[model samples]
Each structure stands twice: as structure tokens, then as C-alpha cells.
Target: MFGSLGAVTLLVSAVLGQGFATPKANGTSGYELKQGPLDTPWTEKVGTTPWPEYPRPQMARSEWRNLNGVWQYRNASGGESEMERPPFRQELESSVLVPFCLESALSGVMGNYTIHSWYRTTFNVPDSWTERVLLNFAAVDYQATVFVNEKQVANHTGGYWAFNIDITDQLNKNGTNELVVFVFDPTNLWPYNVPIGKQKLIPEHIFYTPCSGIWQTVWLESAPADSIEKLHINAGADGKVDITVHTTSNTTTTADFILYEPNSELVKLKIKVPVNKAHSFVVDSPQLWSPDSPTLYNITVKLGSDAVQSYTGFRTISKGVVNGVQRPLLNGEFVFMFGTLDQGYWPDGLHSPPSFDAMVSDLKVLKEVGYNMVRKHIKVEPALFYQAADQLGLMLIQDMPALSTSSVFINDETAKQCPGVSLTPSLDPDTVQKEFDRQLAVMVNQLKSYPSIVTWVIYNEGWGQPWEGNDGVRNTSIDGILTDYVRKIDPTRLIDSVTGWHDHGAGDFYDNHHYSSPQCGTPWYSTPSSPYNSETDHRIAIQGEFGGIGQNVSEEHAWKVAASINAINNTYELDATPKIWNLRAHMILQELEFQIQEYACSGAVWTQTTDVEGEVNGMLTYDRRVNRMDKDMWRRDIQGLYEAAARRARTNGTMGVEGRGGGGG
Candidate 1:
């Protein structure tokens, strides 16, 4: 095999022209790569193919295979080789790690191309488990075709949603079975490339390196012919939680739900309900979940022969008048959400984290820094990320990866091309809006159960939305349609219809994104005079994005921050050799305090959680190595801002409603 220690040494020399001793993969069935910059403990502890933990924590089954180690890979572009036998191709070019993008260094194949990348591996089914075998993929970029024993089994066409194939008939009972996958991601090559978030083939400013092919986990599970497939558990504030189970078996089955507090004693209780019916359980004196306490009740549901583990928190989100202003209420009280934007990117694992612990570490930073929410900008993270957020008591504002007729970059060039327009993707409006809608529905259904997700952003600056009328202006009718459509699906959370730029007077909150200098003395409020304000419609005010204060890390790693200088005030310089890192740090802290304490702000999401590729506006660096702002100094102020919101709610006095807006004016 080409993945042995000796082969690793040879491979490293061949790839990077460097000779180094090959280290063993941490107690797993693969070789570890030579260390890269920004490697975390999880990155070092990555066993075999990185994400070794259970991929799906919300619906976790113990009986599953982690098919995420070394696999034979070859560029399937006009290669003269056999595609139907063992090893697949006669001359397999290289070995790549499964679930990591080929472009990523962690994958062991650092080539970044959009052509068909064929992945081949073999796995044996346990003889004891014999009813049915299912092959699952957490996500594959663009499109993928699966083959079992050289026979086509299934095909999927979404980059952000999970798909599965019932390979029961395709599996070989006697010995190991050959599995092959072909993936083609056109990226922004065509109009109908699907919503790829910030992926760009040419990778410059905001658009990042393209994450091509399987960027998540691939696994196999065996289940009874008739068994539980999916579980949707919605928790409520009234000491009750609702469970809906989707089963594959038609015969009678009972769902046994066991509850625990996740402590040393492991105290437990059980509730049994019919598999096909919706069941509700009243948790007597349930401890409500919040960012401060973060209380969670563990749940283990067993349906016939299939059992999965999940957890839920008793919390609710609503909109009402508070302190004479419209605000988002948490558990029936006004609570301000203060957080940063999380892109969920890694230095090694682009979309996928280096390991489960690595992903958890990102959330732990937010919890420790006194943040209550994370606006997941334009990326739907893996299930475990959400599970961690739930357990950590961090709320989320998830954004739909914007689709487009063509590539649209949010830049000054775009601003000039389409004046006064925030989002405009239609060169010739592609007919893939249906696909975007389908993926949106999938995203909502896939992540609705997690208690931490409090909002869904449908159209971000009108990425690939309809431009039917008014010179690329956003159509309020379309905004209303999408808002109502998403509301029907999950009415538990608030919806930000069109974040920033265009405002259609729809959705629950008026979201605005600004990067201007802050007014320190004044506490800004959302009034009817604002651009997004409506005369007839009433919604809460939220500073969706603000304060992108750029600070140069160093001369070697400051290109992105230098480029971002033009986006802010003219007074700010593009100092390539900036010596004072503390100057920008002071400005950022003061601006953040102002944004968080704004009189009319119910929530505020800072520019970002970390510095992405070139945009150096994150609180943390791209590698999760450095916190630009001192944690101890910022933590107290951040915590105090949240406390202020709660204090205002308590002392809110009577005020006459002079306008249509909800609470604060």
C-alpha cells in the first residue's frame, strides 16, 4: 500500500521535496501528515482521516462504520484505465483521506481542481448484521455518483445536504465490497453551479479556496429492514418536548425515549410512544436552558431494534415589545444576543474540522469570551457542530448559502456595476432557483431540532435570488413568499429575510450590515428614519454585521487586512508594515462595546469570529491560534452588555405606541 510510513516519507519528499520521518497516525488506521501552520491539538490527535467522531450527534446510532481513512484516489479526467474492478483504476495516482477536500492539505492530495475526482475504497460488512446495509454521505460538493462493486447505486446533486443509498442489494455478503465515488464541482463556472457559499476557483478577497469533493464524513450502518430512520425533537419552554420519528418499518414499533442529566450519577427516566405517532413528554420541574446555565437533558430513543442518542434544551424565542422597543425575547424575557460571525473554516480541514474536538474548541472560545450567539455566515456546519452549540448553550443565526445565476462578489466593483443594489447574481437569471429552494428546505429540516438555532437568514444580499423587476432591486413579493415558506416549515425561530442592503419589510427583524466608524458617545437606535425601516410593518432591530476594524497581524500575513482598508474609512491606512497591533485592538473593543450597547439593538453580530483567508477582521486569527483582543479585558465588557439588556427589560416602563414598530424606538 502507498500509505505506509515509508511511503509517507517518499510521498512527502515527492510532494514538497522535503525529507522527514513519517509519524504514525494517532492510534488510527492511517499515517499522519507533516505538520502544517495553525495545527491544533485536535489536528495532531486526528486519528486516520480526521473526523473520527460520530458524524451525526443529533441522530446518533452506535452501530456504524467510520469510513474516513486513507482511500485510493485518481483524477478521472480522460484516464485510460479500468473503472470496474478492484483498485478501480490500474494505476491509482495517489492516496487521499476520505471526507476531506482534495484541495486541503489534510487530505494528503493537495491538488485543487474541479474535474471528476474518483475515490475508491473497500469495506467488509459484519456477518452478524445481515438485514440491510446503508451507505451515507454527510455532504459532497456539487454532484456525486455512488457505485458499489462497479454498479451504479445512487446519485445526488447538492453540496450542503446529506444523501444516502440503500446498498443492501449492492453489498457482497462473502467478502469485502469495492465502493467508488465520482464527484464533479463546476463551482462558479456556470450559472447553475448551486449555492457554493464563498467558494471561488480563482480565490481572492472574500471568496475562499474551493472545497471540491467529499468535504464531510462518509460512513455505513446496518439496520433491521424495518427500523427508525429519522427523529425530530422540538423542545418547549412549558416543561414539554415533542418527538416525531420517521421509521422504515411498516409493522408496529414502539419508540422508547430515555432522559438523563448527563452527570456522574447518570440519573434516568423513560417514555415509550408509538413510532408513527407524535408524542409529547412533560418534564417535571425541568431546568430551562440558557447561555449562563446551559442546562441540557440527554435523550436516548430506541425504536424497535434501532436506537439513537440526542439532547434538547427547554428554551423558546419570541418577538414582543420590551423597554418601549421591539425586541427578540428569550424564554419570554428580553435578552440581547452578543456574538461574532463564525465561518466554520479550518487551516487544514476547509469545511470539515481537523477533529471533533477541534470543532468543540471553537465553540468553547465563544462561551469563554462571554458570547451568547454565533451567526453562522453562509455555511451550514456538520451536525456535531450544532450538537456542541446546544450543549454549550450558544445560540446560532444560520444563513442560507446564497445561490446565483452567476458569480457575485460583495465589493466596490459590484457596487458600481449595480448601483444601490446589495445582491445581484443574474447575468441571465438561471433556472436553478428551484434547486436553491430545495436545498433551503433540506437545511431547515436537517437543523430545526437543535435548540440553539434561533434564526434563519434566507437571502443574504440577494446572492442568487430573483431579479424580476426594478433594475436588480429586491422584490418584496419574492421576499414575502420565501419568508412565509420558511415560516411554515419552522415557526419556532425568527427569520432575517434579506440581511443588509435591500429591505422588503418582511421577516421578524430589520437586519443591517455596516462597516463605518462608530459613534462612541451616542447609543444608536433603529428609528423609522432608517433605510430598512417600514411605515406599515413592525419588526425588531438587529445589527446583523458591523465594525470590521482591520488590524495587520504582521507583514507576512497582512495582505487581506491591507486590501480591506479601502472598505472602511479613508483615514484607515493599508499599512503593509504596521508596527502597532494594539492601536486597532483598542478601537475594536470600543466599537464592539458601542454596537452591543446600542439602545435599539436586540442583537449584534461582529464582523467575524476569526480572520478568514485574506479578510483579517476577525477577533481570532484564521488558524484559531491568537485572540487579537485580550480575552480577560473584553470578556467582562461583553458580559456587562448582555446584563444591561436584561436590566432594561426588568425596568421597562409604559410608553405610548406612536409608530407601527414593536418595542424600542
Candidate 2:
């Protein structure tokens, strides 16, 4: 039969071809042989799985398996094909490094694969693991069907969430065990069968690249037959941090919970509770969490032989009247949140970071730039990325990766180039609602526990939905559904209902995006203006996106183009770059200061932290090796600006009103 040893024989035969190469003893060697600057020497360092420091830092596990190494892979030709068929192959022609996506350069197989592909790998069970084995995939793009020893086990449909399967019964204790995963992603065309965001088969402007297959860590863990299946921690301003522990067993178990301040001793508490029941704890004088000062409490839960470590923050986020004006309050205090529009992309790894160190480096850079928060622009990152922010105490404004029609305000060329070719349009009301609910739910479920995420941007600049009509009529209701969905899922966080254009008059704050200027508007406009240019009254305002100034540093650029300079006309190219570095820096600093000092803009997200593809409007180059602007000066000015604005808002006792003194729209 094709499903038997014949598949192995066929695979062995196929490996004799020119492209087929034996698996290198060291996994990193294969990554260096791949083509493109996107493919660098990623595998040079091996064994240490730098990210092996527990994939889920927020939710810790003392006893778990790390399945983040080489995995057998073979390209599926398509249709009802058995793994043991004549064309079925697996002689190490290619070995996909687990945890990284196949499309990413780090995977060594930096080549594109059609929607459906079959991957197979085998390993022996460790004798020490006598309990139930749970197979976990951090994330697999689109849809995946998993099988163990040729028997189907589980299936997952989302690309940005985690899923697990219990395979204790299917394991072969004495012999090699086989694991096969089949993935199908039809994201190349429009109106995909599944909800997808900003992924295109062709990498081009704005919609940079597509990430398929396993993009996150894959691992296995053995748990006591009656172990903690899941947990939830809720931190409130009332000094009560609620916890709900879900376990598989129905027996009553003694639970002990511990809380730790940053770099401090652990505060432990023990309580007897029924298994699977919710438990609550009260911490008096809890440390409040906010953008200005993000404080997190480490939590450790023990049940019988099972122990898990996690963290939360005691905070309350709400809209309240401060000095007679409604403003965003954190722990009962009004604070301005400033951040960057961080699209977590890498030159080498694309959607995946080369290592956990690489991921932490990005967050550290943002902190260094004096940004209190970061708007995770459109893409949902791995859990550890948020963990880094939570541990490092950085605020987060997360956006659900958008999946709808391209914005109308985008340049006509960009509009034509990146339209809803394979996306469910906003006009399909049912699809829109379904996708909106599905994605919003997934986003919230994946990120809600992290205290760093204080705000949710439901929509960004109307990229996926048209908030304005052709006749210039604004549709605030359309934007309301998104904001409402976010609030329904996670009422604790603030919402930037419509980030760029179309003031829906909804959401907790007045959010706006400006690229060319840092001009602030009045609280209310006597005459209605364009959505992008209009000024609003009655709410705290924020400059959501601005300062897309670009400065090219020689060594940091990844492209092969030679540096050019046209000093006379001030046009800078690859080689002869312009001396306008200082000019660009000054403009950004002055505009930022103006928005902060003059306008009292609550917070601002500079265009970005790094250049994405062709949009070279980042403070740093795409490779992250260079900073085009003056780091120290920008940091000092931003710190001073935010401090001054915060002090003024505190003194005024009101959310800064439009036309009061703020500048830039």
C-alpha cells in the first residue's frame, strides 16, 4: 500500500536527484546555503535554541518538551495523496527548522510553496514521560491537519493562534513515532476561505510578504493525567486579582498562588478549591499599571503535581471625567500614552525574528527611544513578544491584523496594486461580521492576559474598510461595530475606533494620523472638514501616526544599490546621500515637540521604528543595524515633551480641548 514502507522507498529514490542533499549534522549550515539577503547565516549557531527559554513566558511550565528542531518535510503535489505514494519523498532533500515559517529565510527553505503541502517527522517517546502527552503548535498559518503514526489527530484553521492535541494513546513507546502535518493556505487569491490579514503571495508595497506553514514554536509537554488545562488571571483596581484555574480532573485540589513584584520576593497564598472552579485573590495596595509606569505582578500556581507560572497587573482602564472632561484613566489617574507604530518584521526572518534576542532587541530599542507604548501594527506576534513588553514594562496598543478592502485614500497606484483581490470585502456584511468576530475574538483571546496591551486599535486608517463615502458622508456606525467588538471581548482596554480617517465620534479618545505635518486641531470644528483634516472637540486627542522622515545610513541598508548623493538638488539615493540628515531630524523633533508642547497631544506613534520594504520612513533601517536620527536628542526631547504635556493635562484638570492650544492635524 502507498501508506506503508513504499513511501519511504520512493522518498529515498527521489533524494538521489541533483537538488537533493543529505541533512547536515549541524542544522545551521543549511540556512547559510539558501539564496537572497533575506537568507543569511541564521543557522550558524545551533543546539541552544536561543528561544528555548520557554516559549510561553507569561504561562510557565516546569515539565514540557521542546520540539523546536529539525523536522522532515516533503512537497505535496496535491489531492488525495498518501504519504507512502510513489512521488512521496523524505530523504532530507530539505529539513525545515521548526518554530520558523517555511516562507521565512531562517527556515533554510526560503522558497514559496503552493497552498497545500505535506510534512512528516518522526521521534521516539522519552521513557521518563509516563503521563499524557500534549502536542502543541504555537501557530500554523491558515489551516492544518495533524496526524500521528498515519492516524489523524487534530486540525486547526487560524494562522495566528495556538492549538494542541493529546496523543498519549497514539504514541509508540518502543519504536520511532511518526508525526505528519498537512497545511493548506489559499491566501494568494481574493476572498480566501479563511480570515487572513495583509498576506500576499507577491511581496510589495505595504503588504510586505506572506508567512505560511509553522511560524511559531512547536513543542510537546507531558502533564499529569489530571493537570491544569488552562488558566485566566484578572487584575482589577479594587485590589482583587481574580484567577480561574481549569483542570481536567473533577477532584478537589489544594491550589497555591504566589505574586511577585519586579525583581522582588514572591508573595505566596494557599487555598483549597474544587478543580476547574474559579478562584479569586485580593492584593492590597496593588501596583497600578499604566503607560507612564507599567507594573506587572508575577504569578505562580500549583495544583497537586502541576505547577504553572504567569503574570498580571493590577490596573483599571476606563473613560472618566477629569476636571469635568472625560479622559482615559489608568488606575484612576489620567496619563498620556506615547508609542511607535511597530510592524514586527525582520529583514532576515520576515514575520519571524531570528531569535528571541532579536525580538527583545526591537522592544529594547523602542524603550530606548522613550516610547512608553507600541502600537503592534496589524500583525499579531508570538506570545513571548508581548511577554518581553510585560516584563520590560512597555505599554501596548494592539491592532487586529486587518482583512478587508484597501483604503480609498491610499495613493491610486497603491490602491490598484493592493486591493481586495483575495479578501472578504466590507460590502459582504455577513462575511464582514463573521470575519470581524472571528479575528477580533482570536486577537483578544490570544493577548488579553498580557497587562502590556492597554489599548486596542480596531481599525487602522480605514485600510480594510471605507469609513467615508464617496459623497464625503462619514459612516461612524461601520467603525462602531469594530470598536464595540473589541470592547465586548476585552472591556478593560481603550479603543482607537478609527485610527486614521473618518471621525466616528466613537471610541474613548480622538485618534488621528498625519504624515506630512504635526498640526493639532481644535476640540470641535465649527465647519465640518475632511475626515483626515477635521478637528474634534469633547475628547482627549492623540497623534496616532506621524513623522515618516527617512535618513539612509550606509551600512544598515540590505539592498545592493550603491549609495548616491545629489547634494545640489538635495536628492539622496543609494550612493551620494543627501546631507539633509540633520534637517530631517530637526523637522521630526520640532514637529513632535509642537504636538506635545503646543497641542498637548496625549501621545504619538512615529511613522515606524524600522523601514518596511520600500517605505523607508523608519527611525532605523530595516536590518535594525542603524539609527538615522539622533537617539539621545530625540529621547530627551520626547521625554521632556511628554512630561510637560502630562503636567499641563494634570494642571488643567481636563482632557485638552481642540482649539485650546494644541497644533497639527
Candidate 3:
């Protein structure tokens, strides 16, 4: 759920307590608040001192600094290269709150910057600390160059991953030091073929307003010159999980592993090993991790003079035959995956949510609606968001934000209603390869932990795709390269080479996307005469996308007019006569159930969880203030579907297929 500026402002006031009145319009230090859902006051409350939770839950450490909050910003004249510059000889431009995007109202400068811009802030180092200080940006969109105390520290190019630089060598030991960042994004100047999902300079028809600059929290942490930098955990069904710790130091250190089941001690092992060494520990009778009963094992590792905390789960995801049908195996048993296409977007925050709580709310809402998993559509979220999913017991199917230059389109009857509104396709080969490698590496490195992620989708619907086009036939050799690359990087997880419409038939699963109707694929549910009613003959069938029925509640609308779906006025008011929209939603769910039963699909991911900008087809409205579908009804339907599917699998004498189907007894 997204928070509007007003709602956020109220939250800010509530959190910060009294005496923190809204800044007056002409005040120098105080910012002139922008009026918008994303510009709300609570955003301003995100202070520089106590920024996001310390120890970064996933990788825990005792010493670190929170560098979030108010920062001095200036629209660059496009020439300055230094951090400290003469105060603009002209009237001072408005100051922007740190972390939020410049386009967001909360930033105080609710305007877009086509050219590069600069941000400045100052902080003092503790006299007691003698170790190196590192500055980290959770994320900086497009491109970023950082300087500390007038010395250039680091330069980074991706927007969705975290990067850090050691600034201790350049820090001013005793006094306050200056930090500045220069960001340049071609959001407006770049060609429209960038494969940008929701972002738009002029948002309309499924495109959302652009988010530029720092849309995530930035902070600092202090660590020894030689310290553990990263830890990667891999758990297998054999009760042995490998731990790889990357460290800057070369000293010998002892690593410890502890396994925990719900309210019980499962196993514990401690071993002395060389720093940066990979270690594996075997546990007996390990409790497997799953969405229904999410079991996690807490692990703490200690290095010489340093120690960090981490966690992992003993589980395995595989693919095999169940009832002569391919299916995903969880802990060596078939567990039908049910989820939604979660395009993480906030009404008020654009790419950023008002607060961490707001991000968690979206996941909470999904769980409440009976979804066990979520396909994080395109955009990569902050680490904390993934942390929430892991702790809250939700599975994740992470998708690499579509990159390339190919356009995608749906060909069903609904798609025909909206002619000429297809996705832009085709990408420069070099550019595609570069972006794909960079984005894929960043995604894998950042999300390798946290038991929630089970699958990694390499491409979605051929957006910016470079396929072999021959009279409506699209084929590509890139799918194999991508699949092999992901497999090498993280062999434990499943990879969907191409999601929706396009099928390379080379990836781990057979994925498909449908909308508003239930139609079976080639051999299973459909034949020459009865094509639309039966299942496909594919090994493993999944409803990758479905149910985009529109139901708009007027009073809750942030945008004045109802948006079109498939270029039609299919939008209906929540309180309209007979509430036809309600009936439509019910029918959509019913159709889903019917398709699941008839097709024997292993899993299904709904069209979406929340309305994203112009795409108001989410089960939950954009802000998440209202639920379009009834929660109780959805839960009951999913429960019934799961039971029925399980029953069928058991009855067919295909139970315990291990590789594909059957529950672990």
C-alpha cells in the first residue's frame, strides 16, 4: 500500500511527536512541502541519524552509522565537479529531503532533472573509532558518483543494488566532513525503448511517473580494515548446507552454524577455519523449509576480533514427474505454488514506499489474501523488503527487471480490443548483453540468501527482446545463454528463461501467461475442435498471469478518471447498480479454479497484487487502502483448490514421485 503525502505527513508527526510542526513556506532550513501522496510529511521524518534498522538484519554487525535524512541538494549547472562549492551566488534553490526521489513531493523539489544533479551533506566521525568507515548507498538510480570530504570515493551504474566504498582513507578525523553525490539519469532524454516498466516522463496507459536520483536509504558503517565482507549460504536436502564467507582480512577464524526448528533445537556445529574459506556442516534430521510451515535456522559466525550473524534454511526445490506430469518439488515433494505478480509500486512514493512499514504492508496483504508466494515483477526491492518476506514466511519468485529492446503483446481477444498498444521490442545486442549481465549479477549476489526466493525469472514477455522474428514466429538463442548463466551463478534455484507469451522450451519450467479467461494450451486442455477448454500437454503447466478484471472504487481514486484496461471502459464503480464488477471478480476466481481442476496446473500467479499507476487491474487498489476482491472468499477458494489438487495427485497412484509430485510424509 502506498501512502499519500498527507497520510505520510500525519505518520511523521505521530512518530516524531509534538513541536515538529510543518515547515513554513519561506523558512530557510525548513523545506517547502510539496502537495502529493508521495510528498507527505512522514517522509521528511526519515532522519539522518537513526536511518533504517541497524545491523541490516540479513548481515548483522555491531558497529555502523546511519547516514539517511536531510541533505542539501542543488540542480547542477552541469559543470561543477567538486563537493564543496561556493554557495550559489543566486537565490538558494529549494532543499530536498534525502533518500526520496526528486520527483517525489516529499523531496521538497517535486520536479524532474533531465541533466545531472548534486547532493551535499556533512557528518562527524567518532573520535574513539580507529577503523575504516564505509559509505553505502542502498540504491542510486541510473548513474551515481560519490565524493567524501572533497575526494571522489566511488562510482556506480545500476539503480537497484547496493554499493559501498571505503571512505576512512579520505575522512577528516576530527571535524565534520562533507559528502556529495552526483547523479545523472536519462529518464526523459533516453529513447522510449529502454524497457522501463512503470516509469514514464509523461505517465499514461500503464506507464508510471519517473523516479530519479536516490530513491532508497543511504548510510555509513565502520569496520576493521580487514573484515568479513559477505556471506553466502546454500542449504540442500541432504541436511548439509555450505557457507561461503568473503572477507577482506586473511586471518584465521572460526565459523559456527546452528539449526533451529519451531521451538526446538535441531543442530549446532562450530568449526575453526581459515578466513574467506568455504565450510559445510551436516545436520541429522533437518527440518525442511516451506511456505506452509516456514522453518528457519539461525546461524552466527565469528571471525578473529569480529563476528556477524546470518541465517539459512535446510530445504531443496526440484522438478520431476507427478502422475506423469512435471511439477515443482519442495523438500522432495509436490507443493502447488500459488502466488501473484507483485509489481512493487506505491501510489504516493512512486518507486519508494513512504516507510518500511508500507512495504511490509503489501506483503502482509498478499499473505492475507491466501497467496503463499509472490513473483517480484521486474523491480528489485530494498533488502529489508526481502527480509520481511523471509521472516513473514512468504516464498518469492524474483524477476530480473526486463531489459533489452523487444516489444511484447498479448494476442487474446482482450488484447485485440487494444490494437497498436504493444510493448516495444528489439534491443542492441551489445547493450542487451551488458545490461543483462550487470543486472543479473547484482540480483543474484544480493538475493542469494533468505529462504523465500525459490525461482529467478531471466526475462519477461520479451520486453526489449531480440528474438528471431520470422512472420510472427519469435525464437531466441539468448534464452539458453541466460539460463546457463543463472544456473552457474546460483544452481539451487529454478530459472524461468522467458516468462509469458514467448516460450523457448529450454528453461526449467513451462511458463505461460493468460488474462481474463481460462484457455488450455496445445495438447493438454485443448484440441483442434475444443481448443479453449482443456489443459496443455506441457510437462508442467502454470497460470503465469490471469484475472485482470477491473473494479474501481471512485472515492478512493488518486487519479481523477478511471483508467482503461485493454483500451476499454471496462472500469466499473464499486457501488454501481448490481455491482457487476463484484460478480466479474467472483467469476474470474471461479474460472481460475475451473482451470486448475481441469488442467491440473501445478501453480498459478494472479495478474497482480496492487494497481500500478495506469494499470488499475490489481486485486488491491494502488494505495492498498481497499481490497477489490473479498478476502474470505479468496482464502476459501484457494484452500479448496489446494485440497482438491492434492487429492487428485494422491488418487492417481502418482504420490511421492519425489522428482515431481506428492507431499513428504
In terms of lDDT, the best-performing candidate is: 1
Task: Please give each candidate's TM-score.
Answer: 0.83, 0.82, 0.83
Candidate 2 structure lDDT: 0.63
Q: Where in model 1 is the C-alpha error above 4 Å?
A: 1-47, 78-91, 250-253, 262-269, 408-430, 469-471, 518-537, 555-598, 650-665
lDDT winner between 1 and 2, please give it. 1
lDDT of each: 0.68, 0.63, 0.64
**RMSD in order of candidates:** 8.9, 9.3, 8.0
Tell me the lDDT of model 1 at 558. Answer: 34
- Tens digits of per-residue lDDT, candidate 1, 1-665, equal 12111221232224422111112223323433644434444565665645656667667665666687777776765422333333452335566777777777687776645446787777787776767888889999878888998788988988888887889998788987888888877666533357888876555566676788888888887777777788888877887777788888665568788888643226557778777667777878777877776666767788767777667778888889865677787788777887887888786777878876678787888788788999998988887788778777898999998763345332332122322222343444435767778888989999999889999999876666676656855556878888999999888889998877567778998777665343221234333225433234468777777666555565343323334333333323332322333355445445444443444557777777876777777777676767766666556556656665665556542232122121110
Lowest summed lDDT window (length 10), candidate 1: 656-665
Q: What is the lDDT of candidate 1?
A: 0.68
lDDT of 3 by residue, 245-348 (tens): 78876656655444444333443555554557767767777767777666666666666556665667678887877765677888888877888888887655
